[model samples]
Structure formats: structure tokens, C-alpha cells
Target: MPSLPLRAALVLMLVWPFLAQAQPALKVALFEVAPYAQKEGGALHGLYIDLVRGLGAGAGFKTEIALMPFARVPLALERSEADLTISFSTEALEGAAQALGPVALVDSVLITSLARSTRELPQLKGALVGRARGGCQDLAQRAELALRWTDISNFDSALRMLALGRLDGLCLTRDVLHHYSALASIERSRLGAEILVGQRPALLYVRRGLAPEVIAKLRVALARRSPVKAD
Candidate 1:
């Protein structure tokens, strides 16, 4: 007969594969925003996507990614439908998840038609500005600007509105503006001016009550990746 220790080891070896297979995959959620998270050809790709994939690999957890509209991101976290996400720092999001500090930063800016003479926030007091629906627009209010706000479905639509003279300006990250514009083959001279509003840090957020070990592993991965600066 086999020794007691040998028998125990044999049992463990027999069930180890099943034990490993029983582990659940981490659920990660992201919103569709070009250059950050973009879905094309039914495949997801971009900065945040790559970061999350790397973190999951380093943490040794299988990760499942879901792409949805911005409005649903916080709601998913609130309902425990998602385990992780990356978003611009905002009170609304922080209320739903624990921010793990900034992984990147984004420059919020206002862009207008090249023909429009209004180049600054104060200059367009009451002018209509387009913003992505469900996005944070506290910058204008914080700056004490009473700009008329209009919600657009996405960056592509906002860019189209700006080009068609439907919106006085568009308020979003500078990189997003440049990205969509480039994709649409719009030239720099065609856009009026970029007014720097402020910089918002993009943070890695995990839903509350997530496994502490998982969070710790991600933190270690993030630290190893080095902090990404503003785009």
C-alpha cells in the first residue's frame, strides 16, 4: 500500500485540475470611448483594454471584458454586475466603486468650429455645447459658466454635430476630439480652437466588496506598470 503522505498527494493531484477550473473569471466593464476603449470589427481594443488585460494576466485571473455605454458603467458596478473598470475620476463613480488612484490623466477641453470666434469658455456664455450623455460636465458649472449643454450619444455624433454647425462647441477630452476628427479625416484648421478646461485623472476602479486579494494583486500589477501620464 502507498504511504499516507503519498496517498494524500495522489488525491490532490487528481482533483487539482478541477479545482483550478472551478475558479471564476473576473468581470471587467468598460465604456466605448476611442483611444481609451473602442470596439471595432466586434473586437475590443484600446488603452484601458490593454491595461486591464495586463492586470488580469499579472494577477493570474481570467478576465471577461464587457463594453457598454458610459451611463451603464456605474450602474453595473452598483449592482455588482461588474468587478472592475477604468474611468475619469468623478464623485458619482467613486460612490459606486473604490478608486485605486490614477492610472492615467485626460485633458478636458472645449472645441469649436474654426469659423466660430468664441475661443474660450467665458466667451461662449449661453452658447450650446455638446457633451457625451452620462458624462461628467462639472467643469463648466465649476467654472461658473452658464453654457447651454446638449447631450450627444457619442463622440462620433458630437464631432458630426460640430462639423454641421449644430453645436456651438463640443466638450470632451482633447485626445478623443483629435481621434474622432482624424478618423473622419477632418483637418486641424477645420476646428476652431481647443480651450483647456482642466485635467481629470483616469482611475482604476474596483467594485466594493471585491476580493481583497484580487485588489492587492491588481495594485501590484499597476505599480509595476508605472503610472501613465495625461494624454
Candidate 2:
């Protein structure tokens, strides 16, 4: 028979495997992002939602979804309301969110009112353009567009301004404009969605101190996906 200390050590060693095997659920935060992550009848659907679930499978984690406003995802992670976020701009990652890498999940676009002949970023040179505040920095930077700019509060405001002819053009993501414009009676022909050449970099933010194996499994899965490309 071993001493009490040795017996305690052996008991801990025996229980650790069972404790580790009983993995905690991974809480993933998301918002209403159409064609990418949309919640209907309490279920998530789209490429990103699928991707996260797939990665979770690889990591042996059961994912629990938490739906919130787009702006609150990071805050959810901060408060431990979630263990991860669906996807967000890597540049915006701060606090407890640690970026894994860029996800080439969607295309960026330049939206123009029907009347304007702004076919692309270059054509909008010298025209007044509105960008969603803190959105599409990569597009602007990559395009090297030289235009008068304003920071609008959200895409809805920018879309309204465009309809009223307050702004000549706006930069936004494809599905975002696609989903929201239809809500406002804006036709696709009325709004030109020129898919930008460069890809928008999306990142998966995990809560700090999450099991490294989880992140590693995600990295492996991401690597196995289609390579990022211009649309």
C-alpha cells in the first residue's frame, strides 16, 4: 500500500482522464448574417455556421449557438457568454478574443445607386462615397480608391442615403447588401454589387485560455478548406 500522498496522487491521475473526456460545450456567438449565418426557427444555416460546426466535430466539441446582434458578439466573448464568435474582422479583435486567422468566407462589394454609372471602385473616383463605420477597411485599402468618404452608422442608413441620392456609392459585403436591399425595395439592378478583387479577411475569435487543441483542430480544418480567392 502507498502513503496517503502517493494514494492521493494516484487517485487524481485516475480521475483526470474521465474529467478531461467529459468536454464542456463550446458556446458560439453569432448574429443575423444572411447567406452566411442566419437564424430561422431557432436554427443556424449557411457556410460559416456549417464551417464552425464542422470544426467543432474535428475538435470533439458540441457547439451551442447564441444569437445576438452583430455588434454584441465580441462583448459576448468578453463576458463568457460564449466561448467563440462565428466570424468577425480580425482588426476588430480585442480583449479576450484571440484571432486564429483569415477566413475567405465572403466577398466584399461596392454598391451604387441605379442612376450612378459607378461600375467599380475606380469609376467612383472623386465621388462622395459612404462606408459603414468600421466596415470594409480592407476593401478601401486594397482598392486604393480616391473618393470623398463619409462614415455611416450602418448599412441601412447608407442604403437609405443611396436611395435618396445623398451618397454616390457605398462599400459593403455581398450577402449583407443582398439581404437588406430587398427589404428596402432596392433591386439588384438598381444596386450594382461589383465583387471586389481582394478577399475580405474574416477571423474566428476564441476566448483566451481556451484549450489549445481546439484552436489547433480549427486551424487544421481551415487548412483543408478551399483556398481564398477573388470572386
Candidate 3:
């Protein structure tokens, strides 16, 4: 028979391990955007969301997503407030965060007002171009041909600004723009014109200095997930 003191000690030992095993779960930051990262019915859902869930499951970790404004993603990652981010481009990850697999997600498009404008033709050279802040650096770098840029908070704002002739053009993910255009009931005729100036491959971004094992595990999981097809 065990003494009362021995039974108490045994109980403590068993409980201590469970408490020790309850480590903090990783936090992934997601922005409210369509087909990529968005909150639907109080839950995160999208292509990137699905991919991240799969990666988390394969890596044997719990991932909790926090939805933040699009402009704040870089700041959150830099401050270590978020463990991971999705749909960022290579150039975007350079100074912001360490990136994982290419993901090779969506392509961006250059959109110009269809109306005759004072700006140059076929491109935004020497014109004011509007883009979502912290969205995709690759598109911004390519659109630097005009040498002028305007940063907006959201896609709807960019579209409205362009429609109101406040900006010479807008650069955004092609699919995202189309989705918002439809949701906003934007008249197709209202848009001046658009051009597919270039394409960019998206990637998953993690805070710099994450555990190497964690990164390797994430990469392996993403590779097994395969490339996402265009919707």
C-alpha cells in the first residue's frame, strides 16, 4: 500500500508532464483577401489557409490564424507578432521575413483606367500607380517603370481610387481584382483598360530566425501539397 505522501507525489509527477507539454501554439497572420487569405463565417478559409492547415497537420503543430489588415502584415512579421504569413512575393520576403517554399500561387496584372488620361499609354511610366501596401513587392518593382507609387490599405480602396481618376493605374493580383470587381458591382465599361505586364510567384513567409527544423518540415510538407491551380 502507498502512503498518502507517496500518492500525492505520484499525482504531481503525472500532472507536471502534461503542464510541461502544453507549449504555446504557433500564430499565423492572415489578411482579409479573397482566394488567398480571408475570414469566412468566423473561420479562416482560402487556398493559403488550406495549404497552411495541411502544413501544420504534417508538421505536428497547432496553428492559430489571426486576421489583420493587409498593410500591417509586414509590421506584424517584423515584430515577431506572427509566426508565418502567406502569399508574399520573393522581393517582399527579402527584408520582411524568411520565406519557405515558393508556393507559386497567383499572377498579378497591371490595370489602367480605360478613359483617356494624361498618363502615358501601354504602361504607367511617369504616372501615379496605386497598389495595396505590403501586398506584393514584385509587382511594385516591375511597375517602377513609371517611377511613381501610391500605397492604399485595401483592394476596394485601390479600385475606387482608380475609378475616381485619383490614380493613373492600379496593380494587383489578377484574380483578386476580378473578385472584388464583381463584388463591388464595378461596371466593366468603367475601367479604362488593363494589361498583363508581368507575372509573380507567391510564397509563404516566416519570421526570420525560426527553428531550422521547423522550416525544413514546413518546406517538405508544402512540397508534398503540390502547386495550387488557378481558379
Which candidate leads in lDDT? Answer: 1
Regions more than 4 Å wrong, model 2: 1-22, 88-90, 94-96, 114-116, 120-133, 140-160, 192-197, 227-231
Local accuracy of candidate 3 as per-residue lDDT tens digits, 44-122: 7887788777778787677888878776777788888988887666444567798776665566666777653433443
lDDT of 3: 0.73
Candidate 1: global Cα-lDDT?
0.82
lDDT of each: 0.82, 0.70, 0.73
Residues 1-231 of candidate 2: C-alpha lDDT, one tens digit per residue:
899999999999999999877878899987655666778887778667876787677667788876666667777777778888756463444665887776555677777766665456666767677765445666556445666778765567678878777888877777777777876767556554454644566676788777788778777876776634323
**How many backbone clashes can be found in candidate 1?**
1
The 10-residue segment of model 3 with minimum total lDDT is: 115-124
Itemize residue pairs with steric clashes in candidate 3: 113-192, 114-192, 114-193, 115-192, 126-146
lDDT of 2: 0.70
Q: Write the per-residue lDDT of candidate 1 for residues 67-152, one digit (tens) a residue.
A: 88887898899899999999876566879999987777788888886556465567777778888764655565555677777878
What number of clashing residue pairs does each candidate have, in the order they appear? 1, 0, 5
lDDT of 3 at 213: 84
- Candidate 3: lDDT of 183? 77
Q: Considering lDDT, which of the candidate structures 1 and 2 is the better prediction for this target?
A: 1
